[model samples]
Target chain A: MNETGRPQELPMSNPRADRVRDVAKLAGRPARLKRGRFLAEGPQAVREALVLHRERTAAGESGVVHEVFASESCLDRLPELAELADGVALRLANDDVLAAMADTVNPQGIVAVCSFVDVSLESVLDAGPRLIAVMCQVRDPGNAGTVLRAADAAGADAVVLTASSVDIYNPKAVRSTAGSLFHLPVVLGADIGELVAGCKERGIGILAADGYGTLNLDKLQDENAARRLGASAASSAYALEAPTAWLFGNEAQGLSDSELALADHRVAVPVYGSAESLNLGTAATVCLYASARSQQAS
Target chain B: MNETGRPQELPMSNPRADRVRDVAKLAGRPARLKRGRFLAEGPQAVREALVLHRERTAAGESGVVHEVFASESCLDRLPELAELADGVALRLANDDVLAAMADTVNPQGIVAVCSFVDVSLESVLDAGPRLIAVMCQVRDPGNAGTVLRAADAAGADAVVLTASSVDIYNPKAVRSTAGSLFHLPVVLGADIGELVAGCKERGIGILAADGYGTLNLDKLQDENAARRLGASAASSAYALEAPTAWLFGNEAQGLSDSELALADHRVAVPVYGSAESLNLGTAATVCLYASARSQQAS
Candidate 1:
């Protein structure tokens, strides 16, 4: 073991080695499912995975990161990863080997093999999440990842991906999350109905973000402010400051009538200009931040 | 002209045709500049370009769209494009021809040759804009496009891209705008110092959206709320409702100290969680929407 108590390793030089191929395979959904692991590419994602793994292992929890393959330059740039080497397997690899093992064209010199980090819906709800982002049938991987990142930035307790949504483990989605995938609990493949029920049982108001909804987001914000100032009674069901779980729908078709009915209120972010609508990622960020701001103010 | 006042056309069946090659060349910056035109791909963009072209021609302004090449199915789906045929050249092309002329893998069966619609900095400033978004040295085409889309949705009168920023005419950037590129005035390649001076002279306060800014966005929103309620004087330079132009910097490096110094106030969107920061698109959306909401309320 090295001074950091991590197993000593020889540098991996072969780009076509079996280990490199195996790591690369995790980029696909079937390979990830079969191996029970996914590749977190780039320095930010790998560092986050390693840090979380160390914290979880210290807390006597199952470690998420199994192995980290980094180029010499990446290791030199991030000396903090050295301390994390004690709990996780760290391997130095040639730039070509690291590139071969990564999904992105430019993997930023580091990649980590992490076990599936998605938590169960029941667990996420049981923790009494104050703010949650529920993506229903969101197909685009980039949008899904951006929503996850937005939710994390807004301080949401968790993100719930409906069964029909894109796989959270998709490499593009993982890379898009930037490191927030490791920062927060993301519950995937949860049934929307069950998730809504759980949120309702936990006193979480479910708000649907739709472009054609009756409830106006600006008006809701005003109402939230009024309620906070004690100028109005807390009678409105669409209060933005309430413990909320925002339900965002598909990219192209948006939420179906049945899906919109599931929410306490279907809220529309006011379109002040001639642009048709905000894209899924931008809309979700506005909605999530609205709730975050209101909750913080209250 | 056809019976619907649309130009009668024989379908161009060959993907290797010179016309198809010429349209495809607009995807590059040099070719676009040489031709004084850019390609707007997909049905949505083409349709918007045609609509804008019709409006501009009616107003005796320079036509924005020179020609639209669409597959039979696309023309059938969007019958409204037929009316635009009288003002702009409308050609029917085979699927392969349309695909060859597009930058995206699937061009959604339509593409338009659009004249450079970006106005001069002086023209944008002369309009006496209310809300505007200024991207400084933003290298990513997608980020630039998204910022434009967000600015348009927020009812911003214009968007200004600094000289060092990515080419707004990039195919990926145009695709990211989702037709908003045709909705508002976008001024490209402006000198940042000159743009700042112009905004200041026009009574437009410049706000820099930075992660480390001392002025908190939430507090600014609160002050705007107080101003709306007549509880606080509207003397604060950081007021959200003011006629303002938000300056966003590059994706990785953010704003330099010199760039931040040009802004009247450096505003940070409060990060409620541990996620390091919001992405460029999301951050711009929040900042723009905050201004939109405040302006509407006041």
Candidate 2:
């Protein structure tokens, strides 16, 4: 213990001690996820966020990291720690205290409280995003992260999550993204009406993925196919064009009538098995990949 | 109390009482999952399994359904209950007991303990499965189920899981499958080498999805370009002409060196996101869909 009431150092080499500390923090939901921030543990998540921070610093900009905390023991173990914290604020906290801030029981001995990088529809759209994934009332953090990852892999423009969806910054969600969350601009809390209007203004087609809807995903991906699925509309040269925005809904209840009606088209993945529907994460991946393939083929 | 020494039946019509019983059971993991049998609570899962059972029975074959338990009080509430329970052995277990057998905390007032269905590798391959999914050491039940669901949707022949993987019949895995488990043949507890050899003997190409490995999935799918990936030779026949199997490993240590070497071909999904890697379930889905698309295009 140090004079500052914080442990002067932490030893991360011991897996047992590390797990014990991490479990304690993650056991309590409140301590694990506070109002303004959440924990980002796990080597994959921490490493990705750290790389994003490094990229910003290398470009002569202040790193995006809000704060960096690592077990004293972890500092010695991680050879690149010094490089990651070159111009960023750093902290030495007790392993347990740091674990308490994490969302997983198995902490990676290092975590970063990176503030959410706010992104806008205009900025993301301006980057020539050909494919965008919009999530509606999908509250599962893991599902949200998976969607972000799928969008990134398919080389989509951006991923925008609606207000009712899970928080993109949630530790579990961020980790699930496998670091793709950092590569893509993730926008949270967008009004659906305003979003649809913004896309309309930008001449971007809105495609809603609804389970109960009639449109077939494979059919929609094929432009040569004449019949469109649900909510088909006339193309406005730029609008109703290829490389459009895709909307996905809540896992249980699915997209609301209002949300479905707002789209220019609705599509459903054809099912041969007895499954009533696909998992939200699986469905999103399939849809995003379908659109990406369509655009690529064209 | 019943003379049979079973606890007194609680009225199911009372929402508060039903909720109390349901929560109590979910807290006790053992009560939710036991040897040889597990709970499948959701309507979709319960319905699908029942339908599969019926299809078999209608074909002049017998099926095993231990018991059908439902809320006696709500028998009149949901008119379809009777039709849904089409001639299954029924017992009016108390609402509290039924809750104990439910997988979810909020019981849907429906559950069943069907005999665990086991399939032989001969039967799976005999069906001329063009696509197969193999999990080397996937440890998460949810991930296992999600993979199975994806395999089913993409029209994979079957999913073979090793003993090192989580139990496919685990309640959480079953729920995650959303009824795909019953729709497809899932073989657990198998020798990896034997399974690989068996598939090879059947002229099926085995592809291991390794994140750290060499082959890019996109390039492999590109038929017009160099379709070569992994150590094995690419089949000149279209992807549909060659039966294929995909192997996924544990979340932490991924596929072992030997397992990767055993692959007829190996491919990695192109990643653009910051996520260290995709979650096991998401990765499996992506690979399965890619193969499906390639085969369709070919």
Candidate 3:
């Protein structure tokens, strides 16, 4: 180890090396689950992982980034990554080696292997989250990632992917997150029934975003506006400003009747146009942002 | 042609037929432009196109769908399609042939050849649009398609793609629209400057959605709330409830200063969380829905 506690670096010029193959294997769910590691591709995701690792290590927590592989030009482009890599292993890799280690067609010259950093559902709930996004059976990786990005952007305390949901560590999902994966706690493989019960017990209102809900999201926004205007006292009616966890369902089927029954209220984002419905990701964003805006105002 | 004005069809058994190659070539921009036709892949898009064509023809306008190629199973699955093919040519093809003519991994057993239905910028402006989404230099086909879907959902009158933006007919984009492409008019190759000027002449307020805008979208929503409360007069302030065209810039660079200056107001969708920013599609959705809700309430 060097003085900074980072492992000695070696130039990786061979794309067919065993190490490259091992890193590339993280693209598959089976390999990721078996190894408990995943590839964070591109400069943006790699930098975020390194930065988060540094922050966690500084706070006496386990680091997230296992190792970083970057071409010389990539290191030059993102010099701060070197500083962020303190106490970590860094490998100088050739373009082909970096490409082979990444899942993207053009990885922008960097890739990192990171341990699964998802927090336990218990841990996430224990922290008393104000805003949470619970995705149920969201099969599309792009939709899953986009929802995560939206959740992060809305300043949601955490995002929970139900037991049947797509793998958050899927390369497409991770890529869709645009580095937001490293920004907040993501809980995976939680039982929906227990999650609902847990949130109810924790004083968090579990709201289901459904197209057929009797509760209109616009009305919810208006209620918040009424509260903001001091026109009415905050009643027992579901208020978006209150601590809440939004339950979103499968892209195709949406929330089944049983799943919808689990929520405190099923709220529909009002569709004024002739177009049938909003996609899962767009619906999630509008719902999260509605809560976010109301909370900020309150 | 049959008595119903629909072409009598035979089962297209050959995957390598000249007609199949001609349809497959529409996946490329050059062929689509040259032939003035594009492929609308999958059941949803194809169904919507045929329905729209029927509606238009019933209203004494030109039909949109020139022809539809579907597998026997697809036709069996969607029996209503037979009714929709009233005046259009229908060809029964093998699954392999349908797949070859589509851009998707799975084309859902049908593809439709439709003439370019984009209206001129002048026609869009002539309609005196209440809600429009103007995408400037948007390069990602997926983002462009998502915006189209969002606009359609919000009941926007039309969507204008600037001359430099991605081809609205791009196969990936067509797939992303999820059939919203046929729900409304989509204008292509419009000059941004003329659009702004045209919107101005029609008393349509052009609001630029930007990250660095002085106006916050939440505040804009608040203004509508205030208006709804009858606390203030609608004055000269740009109102979401008013006839408006939202101008969205490229995903990466956003609106150049010059472009921002062209709009009456530059508005930012407030970012309340640690996420750097919402993706272009999500941002556009929130903005469009905000306007949609306000307009509907008014």
Candidate 4:
């Protein structure tokens, strides 16, 4: 950047340039892992990355966004993105270069190379999180992102994905997050056993979202509401208002038997109709929102 | 004449035959509309079709499933599917035939051609539905299917799709329903204006899921719970326990102005954190489950 904080170089026009290829390579898992960077495509994701980058840099910390590439029209369309990317490496690229640098066909004309945003599990646990969402062996990138976005909406303190779960850095997963990927701290390669143990030590209750679990989620919510309303003493299985960590399992097979056993209680989101079960993302959203409401109300 | 109730014809092994092509055409909307039939692929969907077919056939009504096709290995693996197709035209086919006749590259070895199952909105209202889910211009087949599946899971009495919406009969949408499509009554090509008027006349309330609405869903749920627990009067703009139809709008733009205006109330799912708004499916699921819980508790 020059003294005026404007891009110093000419607009990148070559789609097959080595720099474009390098940026596009972040779409692959191996490249992402090797460089500790991932692609944040589209205006929403790119804007969020830039915002986080600016905030971190302002706070005297390393920024999340490494570099941003955008078409001239995208910059003209979303001027705030340029403002947000103040000190970051924001370079102009033609549509072809932007497209070639992005995993998404459109990328809506902007893509950012973001540093691996996941933090250590210990760091997340140290924050004394009141609510956490964990994905166990969730293979689908879209499902993983949906759950992450839901977790963010639920005001989850953090989100964790086990080693067996899909890599959240996948471009599809990043797009699926709809910018929520930049909103919360994430911990990858987490071991469920350690997380369970950590939460137990922190007085954080663990609930497994199981289809066949004995505890009905509605019953639990009703009990929580009853308690809040000062109803007569009822035998409560678990308190929804308490600090909690929810374990969401795979898209197909839910939490394995061992994973279910790790939780303080197995809670079933009551299936009132003939659906064999709720999809993973839907179930996680319901569970997180239920807990978020209960905790927030208290 | 053979008195036994069984498919008298030999297994259909030809993939390129006119009959095979006709069956495959159901994957397209025009063919499906012309024939009034759609394909249900995979064991789960086909099994549900067969079960519904058997039930309808036994009840002195026309069956849903017109013809059943399966590979030998599929029937061998899922013997119950064969039994379910006892009275239906069950034709054994090679995997090649199954693949060619299915939209999915792999149809899981079984497919069923079923008649259009949508009923009129009047009939749905006539049945005294306590909870109905309506999708307004929800173009994505997968999102529509997700909401339908969620509605079914919430035990909603019916689901409705406005004329501007995607055809729920799209194979992808049907698959997304995960067999929930056959569980409850569905009304297609509904006019939102007419639906609102009819629902009002029938005393079924309408709630549009709007992110910018003044009504908070959690507060409404809490109020409903409080009333059930005998709390003093809190002026609730609406009663969630009342017979209701929830209108979920387009995924990207949400409910249009006119669509939102047709509702008795516009309700917002609270975003506890940084997420701008919940996805259509997640919001719909939360709203439906909230109403289901309140109604069931009452």
Give DockQ for candidates 1 onward, in order.
Answer: 0.79, 0.34, 0.76, 0.85
> What are the per-residue Cα lDDT tens digits for candidate 2 across B59-153?
87666454566666545465455465667755555566665666566556667767666588778878888888898888888888888998888
Q: Compare the candidates by TM-score and give the number of the best one.
A: 1
Residue-level lDDT of model 1, residues A66-111, one tens digit each, is 8888777777787777677666778888889988988888898888
Classify candidate 2 by CAPRI docking class.
acceptable
The residue pairs that clash in candidate 1, if any, are: none
Q: Model 3: DockQ against the native? A: 0.76
Better of 2 and 4 by lDDT: 4
Query: Which ten residues in a row are the worst by lDDT in model 4 chain B?
Result: B1-10
Q: Highest DockQ: which candidate?
A: 4
Q: Write down the lDDT of every candidate, Cα atoms only.
A: 0.88, 0.69, 0.88, 0.91
Candidate 4 wrongly placed segments (more than 4 Å) = A1-9, B1-17
- Ranked candidates, highest DockQ first: 4, 1, 3, 2
Candidate 1 segments whose C-alpha is farther than 4 A from its true place:
A4-8, A231-237, B232-237
| Interface RMSD for candidate 1 relative to the native interface | 1.2
Clashes of each: 0, 11, 0, 0
lDDT of 1 at A51: 77
Query: What TM-score does chain A of each model score against the native chain A?
Result: 0.96, 0.78, 0.95, 0.97
The fraction of correct interface contacts reproduced by each prediction comes to 0.78, 0.47, 0.75, 0.87
Native-vs-model 4 lDDT? 0.91
Please list the Cα RMSD from the true structure of every candidate, rounded to 1 decimal place: 1.5, 6.8, 2.3, 2.1
In model 4, which residue pairs have backbone atoms overlapping below 3 Å? none
